[model samples]
Target: MAQDKEFEIVREFEVDATPEEVWTAITEGTGGYLWPMQPPEPRVGGAAAFGSTVTAWDPPHHLTIRSEDVGFPTQSANQLEHTVEPRDGGRAWVRYVHSGIFTDDWDNQYDGASRHTDFYLHTLREYLVHFAPRPVAFATVDGPAASAVPEGLEPAARALGLTAETAVGERVTVRGPHGRPVEAVLDHRDAYFIGLRTDDALVRFFGRGHWGAPLGISVHDFAPDADAKENGAAWQEWLDGAYA
Candidate 1:
């Protein structure tokens, strides 16, 4: 199916945590550390991030939030829905759906949103695994191209400040334009994307255009005691410089 105005992004993920835990994270922590500012309250009629509103709230089973960017009035904004299903051994399966309308130019938006969806879900899993009880600070920054990963991923890894040259289960340190190094490990790296996991955050840096493929960076599970607002601002600044 071609990405069009009616494009709906659907993604599935398996979490090593229980449904109740996942539900609690989504409901109480306002979707669990995905926002730089306050998380949207989960109840219907509650305020949400990006100046959006909550449309649905079903504990541990389903949820939905709707919002729009004033910049594109006709774009219909975004209506995001999440569904959680219980599995054996205290595991859970989660699905995400993003529905929206657009008058024109959806290719880039769809691709970017799709990639972002993946990255955020990965963050969610990380929360369930490491930082479920603690509230968090999350940041995402996007911009123009800097450079592409070389024919191979080593150059890209190096550019990301990764010490390991191989994929999967390797150590990495991604220093954004800010020069502060985020020590992590290579979870996955390819021509299209790079996934790195740290004790406090999960960072996904893009490959094309110097890691500026619209859905740029996704950071989740930073230090719980750290100031969320300040951390978010710092990351945003680093992202801005990295893309510049």
Candidate 2:
């Protein structure tokens, strides 16, 4: 039998800017200032000094750093990795993954990591949204209420309940098959939403909040409702034509 030794935390954010703009923030801009504890060198083999060693680096794309003082011998080789990818509509998405051991005081470490990750992400967003060529807005929703329906979704609203509200700062959660549920957020002004379902899959929906535009959605294992399914197809078609 295989042991569940993998412990990790992953986060993703969409930035209303090009990959280069977002890349600078993560490697050479405000992100460096905020996380002084672990400044990224942002080049292959470049060291990330801050009581830690950068194990790997790939400019404008990926960086991995390791911290020995992570508070647990078992996780002494703890590593954190960041990746950036460009998407449609002059936007980019960033993903951060931190993997390490569970300390005896796991709660404290978890809290600290969570806070730091959030701070870094928010700071990065602020920088990109403020300085990038295009405007950007960031929003996030948490808790069980995030997954609940608003009680009176119109036919259209019901069909596009979560997909329709892709405006910045909108969040929705809907009960999934079985006792599992789905939660999602529209980050920045990109026509996309980040979704998390009970199945633990990270999902992405493209062109969700484009008014008078078609919508695109993607999730693993679960299929969208009949109406939502059609809307997604149309949304993608519109984007292909409009952006192309």
**C-alpha RMSD values across all candidates:** 4.7, 16.3
| Per-residue lDDT of model 2, residues 28-110, tens digit only | 55322142234565555556655567677666677777776765443454777878888999898889898876544455446
Point out where model 2 deviates above 4 Å.
1-6, 31-43, 70-77, 132-244
Q: Across residues 1-244, which tens digit of lDDT does each residue of candidate 1 receive?
A: 3332677999888889888888777756543545544556858999976687888888878889887662564476678888999998889998889887764557766675676677567667766786677656666655334443333233445656655446677775567545767677777665656777788766666544523334355566557565545655676676555445
Count clashing residue pairs in model 2: 3
Q: Lowest lDDT 10-mer window, candidate 1?
A: 147-156
RMSD in Å for model 2: 16.3
Q: What shift in Å separates residue 12 of candidate 2 from its native position after superposition? A: 1.5
Q: Evaluate model 1: give its lDDT.
A: 0.66
